[model samples]
Target: MHRVVVTGLGIKSPAGNSPAEAFATVLAGKSAAAHLPALLEAGVPVTFGCQVPDFDPDVYFPKHRRRHLDRPTQLGIAAATDALADAGTPDAGRPAGPGTAGSGTAGSGTAGSGTVRCGTYVGTGGANIGLTADFGALPHDKLPVATVPMIMPNTTAARISIRHGLQGPCLTFSCACASGSIAIGEAAMAIRYGRIDRALAGGVDSMLNPFAIASFARISALSRRNDAPQEASRPFDRDRDGFVMAEGAAFLVLEREDLALMRGARIYGEVTGFATGADASHIVQPLEDGSVAARTMLAALADARLRPEDIGHVNAHATATTYNDRAEARAISACFPAGSPPVTATKGVTGHLLGAGGAVEAVFALLCADAGLVPPTANFTGGPDADAIDVVHAAPREIERLPVVSNSFGFGGHDATLVLSPR
Candidate 1:
């Protein structure tokens, strides 16, 4: 089996568009949450979220082709394109929009001398649900004819596959919040087992629409601090309410370690381990005992052939909800030794990207390892169980050459973990 390494990353996230920019924002403990005009105009109960700033679809896609794609697809395509380019696979002779048939090397089965086999795997929580809601609000006769193509969750993967001429496997995972992590894990596994030479994998979700926010609000899953949007998502804080809903996309290019080295690719880090499990308990709430989450972490560590003490930093799945923070705290305590690795939760700044959360956090985890610094958990204050683990806040914490674990626990009890190590 081959070893997999991350060679490239791209993001259109609430934190930032580029990995360096996002890492800087996270290190500074900045919150992207803010009042959104669309939410306010729609009269959503919660009118704030971490929306991606300065995102222009026209920059990635042509005006004529952008009309047929949904917001998530647009974000996904942009991220995937950037990721491929970062991996030294430029889209030569490719069209300016998605859904176009591949031409020349872009459509050829082989790229970079026919030695590399590439594929695409992406995840989304809802398949263009925001667009679906828009269609529902419009008259039946006025519905766009391109609805099917625009709304499919697999459209993002398909676009990436076509755009880069990846012919190995094009798949999509829809495991709610764990979707992105699972997709990335599957891609790494494919490379490890020689199914593909490399893969573009990540997650995307553009659900900042009124219907989506209102639905989450109805379920009591959103923070209510509308007046203080910047502090609304206070993960691991005593005053925490619920998660803030955000929309964004993140992608990474994974290649076999030897092949990346052979091509002299700029390796970001190695994906050492990945594991996923379910609580088998509730659809919306995790098991309070955190046993399932603990098992997930243990399994990931085992997969990496490493002990708990080897982990020097943990990127938590803390969403700022009451039950989630408590349960995850217990899980973290159960997984690692006492007062060992520093823990940080990024959702306090980026808000919850649902399916995209895992991918974004994974990127942050890689950046932490690469930069040898653990970003602060924004808005964190002393909470009831915050002492269960060492939560990094106030400022970035520096460490060296230690493995990092990024965890993602989604609704419906889905839990995913990824273990990363410096290259």
Candidate 2:
């Protein structure tokens, strides 16, 4: 088995575009949620959401070529492009094929390989459905000629693979919000098991559209603090309402540890362990007892070959919803029965990113480890379960060393986690 490490990271999120900018923004503890005029004009109960600032696809992809690609796909390409560049991926001039024994195929230098060994793995929820629904509302014959291709969930993965010439397995995981973390976890497994040398793995999602917001609002899943959008997403707070719908994308370049070291790549951190499970008891509600969530965390810890005490901190999935926060609090208590570690929830600031939430939070986790600081959870006031779980709020806490468990659970019982240790 091979060890996997993150050689590069890219993010296009409500917080910020570049990793440095995003991390800085998060550390400052500022809320990205704001009222969208369109939503307010439509009378959506919840008009506030976190949106990527100044998004212009023309800068990311050629306008002519991107006519058929959906917003999520475009965002994915932009993040992936930044990641590959961050890793300083060689564009050309490399040994021939993966068939050649030890010919630099572990994302070290394979841009010119005849049989590229790099793979593309990504995740998104309602990717195609979002675009299709939007176009479906248009008049007949007004849709583009490539409507079929645009509506395929796999379009993101396929286009990413084609654009970068990664010939390995192209996969798309659409398991709701857990989709992002699952993509990262499963891709690491592929590398560990030698299915491929390396992969571009992450997730992208967009629910900022008016229709999606209206549906979520109708279901009462969004925060209703239209007047004070910044103070709305208070994860773990006693007065916490509902999650804020947001959109963005994130990606990571996972490479074999040995290859990354040999090529002298700057390693952010090592992806030591990843595990996933399901609530199974409810569709949208996490098992109130948190048994499944606890098991998933323990499983990830076990996979990382670490005891419960090894986790220095936790990056909670904390959507600020009452049910999820309570369940996750119980689950964390179960994992660390002795005492809880410092926990921070970025959703308070970034809002609930849905499919992109997990990946973006994972990036934040690794960056937190690298920076030796844990950012505060925005608008946190210590909810009823506060005594049981020490929610980090108000300001950042310094913890220079140790592993962090980043959790991402989704509607319909999906739960996925990653254990990252600073390198």
Poorest stretch of ten by lDDT in candidate 1: 98-107
Clashing pairs in 2: none
Q: Give the Å error, residue 308, model 2.
A: 1.2
Which tens-of-lDDT digit does each residue in 285-329 have in candidate 1? 999989999999999999899999889799999999999999999
Predicted model with the maximum lDDT? 1
Every candidate's lDDT: 0.86, 0.86
| C-alpha lDDT of candidate 2 relative to the true structure | 0.86
Model 2 poorest ten-residue lDDT run: 100-109
Whole-model lDDT for model 1 versus the true structure? 0.86
Question: Each model's RMSD to truth, in Å?
Answer: 3.9, 2.7
Q: Taking the candidates one at a time, how many backbone clashes does each contain?
A: 0, 0
Give the TM-score (vs. native) of candidate 2.
Answer: 0.94
Native-to-model Cα distance after best TM-score fit, residue 330 in candidate 1, in Å: 0.5
**Candidate 1: residue 363 lDDT (0-100):** 93
Residue 205 in candidate 1 has what lDDT?
93
- The Cα error of candidate 1 at residue 249, in Å, is 0.6
